[model samples]
Target chain A: MNGVHDLGGMHGMGPIDPEANEPVFHNEWERRVFAVTIATFGGGNYHVDQFRHAIERMGAANYLSTSYYEHWLHMVETLMIETGAISRDELNAEQTKLAKEAS
Target chain B: MAVLTADMVAGLASTGASCRLDETVAPKFSVGDHVVVRNINPTGHTRLPRYVRGKRGIVDRDHGVFIFPDTNAHSEGEKPQHVYSVRFTPRELWGGDASERDSVYIDMWDDYIDPAS
Candidate 1:
């Protein structure tokens, strides 16, 4: 069996390409909106034209390094802070509570 | 911020839940097929770990599709990511020098694999 670290050189071993690697978002909300819109409005598979392009433009390294849910978490957390869905202080407290609970 | 509490977040979670399944329906592929996981990077969340990208593997079993968990993390809700058990030879990922007796197993979705010759 392969451990998670064993994946270091697997598919992403080639030289890093800056042109191919771009941040998919101008800001975090853009990312959240893209995901929300895809999940809520698009097909079983999210296929928004612009958003898809943005994601493709962001190379595989940053993309794959993130957890499946983490991308969404980053997006939504930004959106929450930006759109007032949740305040930064509130988010921090919640996180701390969750961490303490875990401990 | 203090106005919002755990109960409110929990309520939003239930209201936003989205895995959108058709349990009555069947999935398309099985384990062992060489498949390519679609390269996706959404704003809110994802489950596909970065370590396994573009690598090839064989299906080990048919893990039925379910709502993706990444959505839950983003608080956007859940959606299905067809999960499957995939086996990757250590050499394929690490290098030819990797132990011959060693191989790796991964629980990947259908989009993660492509035909391996």
Candidate 2:
């Protein structure tokens, strides 16, 4: 798939600036996302390539704006829903509940 | 579905899963062989990058048999085949203006390339 993720030769994206001692993850949610992705991957629900293709399927605009771990989260959510392991409604319900709890 | 327990986390994290297979698959091209990348644009998952399509390169090294991601991603099957480190000259990939001193070696599967005529 010719997706935005393949940014090898394209120009106009300014030179990358290396962060000074970048943290492994910027947020607590990122840590959980990584763990969940790994766990779900271990469960053998989908192949690693499938996970990658899911990320690629993200629209160009969304794919460019999101962070790396966010991409992983997207892949996890996409596959979980597509494989019937979880439904979009269940995910939405959980998100709504979490939002309420956070408030 | 297999549940991933806490005890398994450490090992799994340390030694990540590799797609490389233990099977002995014959390679289509050998080291120093000139080849051309197949101009394929599959809608499904493919490891072949867009830049390398239809480009000419030389086989640098044979990385042995590995699971083919193109089919594996679509529940098609592993379709294990030899993967090679193909050396593409900067000029060949990026045109004459590119530096001649540098080269890009990309891992290419047998299906992604064909013998150069």
Candidate 3:
């Protein structure tokens, strides 16, 4: 439970650099990812805290390095697999298919 | 049973049924009461942040009853109980160099605290 997400009273994370004129999202994919995550959670498979726990379950190294919405994307994928919503193979196949289609 | 319908999702998105104040089960600590957070290390999910555990604080405000997250996240039960905002002096938690003029107030459930002797 003691993951990077609980960075409350800790020190020495470096200064938080705020972006000037930052867009609502840095890119479009993040918006889609956010929508999917919200929709998945809305599906009633899990509660908000459960989603947070899944996010917290990420390895400390990966959790700390990834961007904010990247964490959301990873956790949503995790919940999808965990709840039998989608299997690992299916997710991989879909991603691969999407990548090919994108190219 | 399956995924929530669009209407249901819309309904679920707006409100929650977690906060419920039960009159029969009274709050043990009241506002201005001094209490110490029980240093518990539960294996599952908990709302009690890691930093605030085992720290002493004053009951600043009664937030009223709400679902206890410790149980709620684990599929145990709602376990609705009175929640109080505990104000901790920065010095009490973070030690020297912490500003004495400022404090951190964390919302704590009744189950998480005990009367400080």
Q: Which residue pairs of candidate 3 clash?
A: none
The CA lDDT of each predicted structure is 0.55, 0.93, 0.83
Model 3 residue runs over 4 Å out of place are B1-24
The per-candidate TM-score of the B chain, in the order shown, comes to 0.62, 0.96, 0.85
- Per-residue lDDT of model 1, residues A1-103, tens digit only: 1223234445646776566566667677567755564443232222222232333334466656875445455544554455555599998999899999999
Q: Which candidate is the best by DockQ?
A: 2
Which one wins by TM-score: 2 or 3? Answer: 2
TM-score of the A chain in candidate 2: the value is: 0.95
- Model 3, span B18-83: residue lDDT tens: 446564567888899999999987767777788988898999998887877788777788787899
Reported per model, the fraction of native interface contacts reproduced equals: 0.03, 0.85, 0.47
What is model 1's DockQ versus the real complex?
0.06
Candidate 1 positional error at A38, Å: 27
> What DockQ class does candidate 3 belong to?
medium
Task: State which candidate, 1 or 2, has the greater TM-score.
Answer: 2
* lDDT of the structure predicted as candidate 3: 0.83
Task: List TM-scores for all candidates, in order.
Answer: 0.43, 0.97, 0.88
